[model samples]
Target: MEKGIIFDIRHFSTHDGPGIRTTVFFKGCPLRCIWCHNPESQKLEPEAINRTKKLDGQEFEVKEILGRYISTDEVIKEIETQVSIFDESNGGVTFSGGEPLMQPRFLLELLKRCREHDIHTAVDTCGFAAPELFRSILPYTNLFLYDLKIIKSDKHKYYTAQPNEIILNNLSMLNQLGASVMVRVPLIPGITDDEENLLAIKEIVKGNNSIKRLDLLPYHHMAKDKYRRLNLPFELEDLEAYKNERLKEIELMFSDLEMPISIGG
Candidate 1:
């Protein structure tokens, strides 16, 4: 009985994948993307987040613990409760993170259980895991919400605290394996949204037939408060969210690729 630490289990999430989904956000991550929205999920162990909220006219402070260690069977039971909803909307389970691949064995077992019950499964990954670990779950995954931040190796390392080599290599391998993947680009202002980076990303997806679609996700400030609660610095505090016109312009750049392109998720 293997158990893994999880920070959150977001139920009925539509933005993560097709249909309704229960996104199991596994704790722990490899990259330290400065703009990460879920700062609490970055750590592998459970952590207490101190928060203050105003009620009536007084401000009260509380310590909220994030992350729970649960076995595969426990997770499966929760998924089974939503089985009817999944059947109704072609939705199932989505393994997200910090990085689900961080806990390969736990993720593998969860995916296997999903398959045994005929659930449609999706893996929302940063694509920074070992090739062998990724290959092991291929047979159980129906769709992959793959993320591609910065294409340049140096810039990627500077922003994410990890090189792009492993991420790119893993994506290319996913294509070669004929896996169904949707390339999700986090349109961070000035970083990933620059024309130079967009073109580089285009170069990588230009001939990848295995890729089903591309999604451009604009940056948001929702994580600002999360950082405050966790006592972590919000690096992109001065940056503004992407405007509609700017997002439209980026979407047009990928038009020539002849692949379906969508803005946001």
Candidate 2:
């Protein structure tokens, strides 16, 4: 049986996809982006972390396990429970991660099962997988929430610990395959929101019909506490989210693109 390590299964999520979605967060990733929001999703195995809890005005630490392995059948059963919700809202299941591609077989199995139940399937990915892996899951995936950050190779490697070549190539391949993709960019204050990087991204999506939308997600400090609990460093600890004025300016940079542009997904 194919089982994938899963950390979370978020139901009634409007941010992950169209309408209300049930997002299955797979555990594991290949890249190490310094500004990752879900730091807990990076590890492939189940692990314990210290979480601070408060009760009756007193604070204490609590130990919590973060990930688990579950079979496709088990996951499908959960998705089945949301069928009525999916049918009414045109929403369905989203396989998110660390990076869903890290557990290709497990993700593929879940996607196949979702298709069998007539559930709309989307994969939220970092595009750091082999070409063949994308091809294998293409048929099963109805939409892709693709993340692209820092186009320059050196900067990309420095921040994400991975090259942008594979990411860019796979995106191009998807465009050629006519896959429905919504490119999502993390607008880190100084790292990814620069004029050069935004212009470069604009060029890539300018004429691509496969890319249906572009979501500019501003950086936030919501995961600071999570990092503290996990004993992980928060590199952008002092960084702030983009102001409305600046976001408007950035949005104008891609106004000429054929796809829909929004501030958040």
Candidate 3:
């Protein structure tokens, strides 16, 4: 009975991976990126949160619990219920985080079970785990939604609260092993979207064929409300979501790459 803490299990998700899918968001993370959208997913334990609800014109306060420990069998049952939908849409389950690799044993078990069910699997990771962790899960994972934030070591450390050495090394290892990787870059306004950082990322994936597509994720302030609910400060409260025109220009930067470039997720 292997159990892992999970904060969310989102169904019919189009942005996580191919077709329609279910994204199983594992709780706990190594890197504490300032612009984290799912601030609730950062901690490993269950969190009792105070939230506000409105009916008609009146406001009411409510209590909600965030993360919970669930058995692998239980999680598999939930995934099995969506198999029909998965089959019809070429969709399957995606294990995402607060860095799923943080719980290696539990994650490995889920991946093995998903494999046993003949389900297409993807791991949305920050690439901050031990190299061996990636190697162990490589066989079970069909695709990887890898996040590559700041490339400069100092800035990467300053922003993510974790050095990029392990992350970069793990990515290089994956590339060497010919893993199917879709590099996702979170375009945080001044931090990650700078010309220098973007260009540095371009250099990393320049010649890699195993690296599939590039997803340029522009920052948005939608999570401010979530932060408010959790009583956490929204660091980028004043930052606006990127406009279409600027996003297009940034998209054009990677226009010549062999792999396709998408603007979101």
Candidate 4:
């Protein structure tokens, strides 16, 4: 039995994929995005996160475990409980991260098991993995929630610790292979939401017909407290979430692409 570190499992999630979904948030990531909301998920190993609460003007702290090492069978058992709901709603399981590809073998096992169980599956990826590793799981993945951040190489490396070369290459290959991919662009203010980045993304989508949809995920400061819980700095603390008007404006940029465009998730 292969065990992997998972930070969280979100059930009844509509934003992760079509219909309702159970999103398994795998721990660890290769790239360090500045505006990352789940700071606790970034680490590969199990760690403790501090949680503080104020009750009647008194502060109390509790330690919460961020990661849990569970086998593939263990996960499948939990997912099995929702099999009926998944069938009724056209929804299934979604492997999200901290880059699920970071735990390739473990993820592959789960995908295989999901296929055996006759469940529709989805993967929310950062698109920063080897082409072979990515393609290996394609047959099992029904939909891909692919993340496309900064298009420019320098800017990509500046925001995320890793370069975008591999990410772009893998995406192109996925397109060439005829995969169902929905490009998810994180609209981080001052970082990923700039005009140059949006235009570049437009060109990328314009060239790739494999892209089924383009979802503009507006930036939010809701994860600021998560950073505080992990004792990590929230760089985007001063930045405000994107207004609906601005997100619609960004959506207009892709109107010429002739693909389904949505603003959230």
Candidate 5:
């Protein structure tokens, strides 16, 4: 049996994608976004020993606890547990991650199985993967939740440790290829919410009709507590969250665009 490292399986999740959906959060990420909420998902490692203590009130030097990666057959069985919920809610399955494309082979297999059952499939990605990876997976996808960070090369690198070259390239290719994609912008207060960067994002994606809709996710310090539990320091320390009114104001720049913009992701 093949297995993939997934840190979370969130059911009845609406924000990750369209409709009511189950979000399968895979482990490992290439970029280091200082505002990341799920810090654990960024690492290939399972939860550390000390972190387990806080979750379960026990302490240990090392914790190799097995994670839940349900079998292909079991996926539908579990998904059925909420089938009525999905039907009523107009939702399906979303493959999210540290970066789902990070585990391309496994994700491809899982998505194949999901499609055989006619489940709607969506991928939430950082657009920081190899072009071939995106090419291989696009066919299996129904919708894409593509995340674009800073537009300037240096600022994008400083915040995510990756230049925006490949990121922009992949997005452009996806658009040309006619993928049904939605652009997600994490409006981190001091970093992403800067008017300059936000305008840059608008200009970068404005012409691409394939990614007509935009979802602005407000940044919060909620991940700080998680970082502390894992003995990791959050680099975006002390960054203020962008206020809701501010997010609405920023959304106005894209007002001329045809598709509607919604705040919160």
Candidate 6:
């Protein structure tokens, strides 16, 4: 039996992809983005998201949680229970992560099984995984909520502790594949809200017809407290959600780009 380390699983989420979704948040990530909301999912540092997790119909956690390895059959069975809901809502399952691609094989099999069950699938990724890994699984993905942290190389590294190489490459591949994609950029007040980053993102999206929508997720400090809970230092404590007007300005700027401007999920 294969069991992948998991931290959280959210159900009936209408935001990630189309319709209602069951988001499977896998544990582990490659980049250390300061503004990461799911700090618990940011590391392979799996133990338990909650020593006493409440398991109900809507939210299900495996009874015997272990290491990052999980059986593919078991996961598909859990997903199958939601098929009726998925069918009604036209929403499927989303394999989110600590960077879902971090466990490439696990994610691939997960996605493959979802497809076999005739479910719509989406991958909420930081867009930082290896190119080959991305190519192999994307064929099974119905939609992608690809995150755009920073466009400039140096700025991106400073913010996420990683380069934009693989990230951008994966985005490009998504464009090339004609895959349904929505570009999600965190509306950080100082770091990501700059003219350069916004403009660069604009250029990239404008150049690709594959992208037709942009979702701006405003920054929040709600996740800061998690760092304290987990004994991890909060790196983005200084940042707050961008002002309403500033966020509107961003939306207005992209409004001219001829895309649907979804403010939030």
Instruction: Please state the error at residue 244 of candidate 1 in Å.
Output: 1.2
What order do you get sorting by lDDT, best first? 3, 2, 1, 4, 5, 6
Which scores better on lDDT, 1 or 4?
1
Candidate 3 lDDT, 8-114, residue by residue in tens: 89999999889789999999999899999888888888889888777998978789998999999999999999999999999999999888999999999999999
Candidate 2 global Cα RMSD? 1.1
What is the Å distance of residue 203 in model 2 from its true position?
0.5
User: Mind giving the per-residue lDDT tens digits that candidate 4 earns over 1-265?
Assistant: 7899998888898999888889999999998999887777788999876777669999778888889999999899999989888988999999998999999999999999999999999999999998999889999999889999999999899999989999999999998998999999998888888898899998898898789899988887678876765566787778887788887788888888888888886
**Each candidate: how many clashes?**
0, 0, 0, 0, 1, 9
Residue 74 CA error for candidate 6 (Å)? Answer: 2.3
Give the TM-score of each candidate.
0.97, 0.97, 0.97, 0.96, 0.90, 0.88
**Candidate 4: which pairs clash?**
none
lDDT of each candidate versus the true structure: 0.90, 0.90, 0.90, 0.89, 0.81, 0.80
- Candidate 1: which stretches are off by over 4 Å? none
Give the per-residue lDDT digits (tens) of candidate 2, residues 56-158: 9997888889999899988998989999999999999999989999999999988988888899999999999999999999999999999989889999999
- Displacement of residue 185 (Cα, Å) in model 2 is 0.5
lDDT score for candidate 4 against the true structure: 0.89
Scanning candidate 2 in windows of ten residues, the lowest lDDT window is: 223-232
Model 2 lDDT, full chain set: 0.90
Candidate 5, residues 87-139: lDDT per residue as tens digits? 78878898888898888888888788778777888999999999999899888
Q: How well does candidate 6 match the true structure, expressed as C-alpha RMSD?
A: 4.9
Worst 10 residues of 5 by lDDT: 60-69
In angstroms, how far off is 83's CA in candidate 6?
Answer: 1.4
Q: Point out where model 4 deviates above 4 Å.
A: none
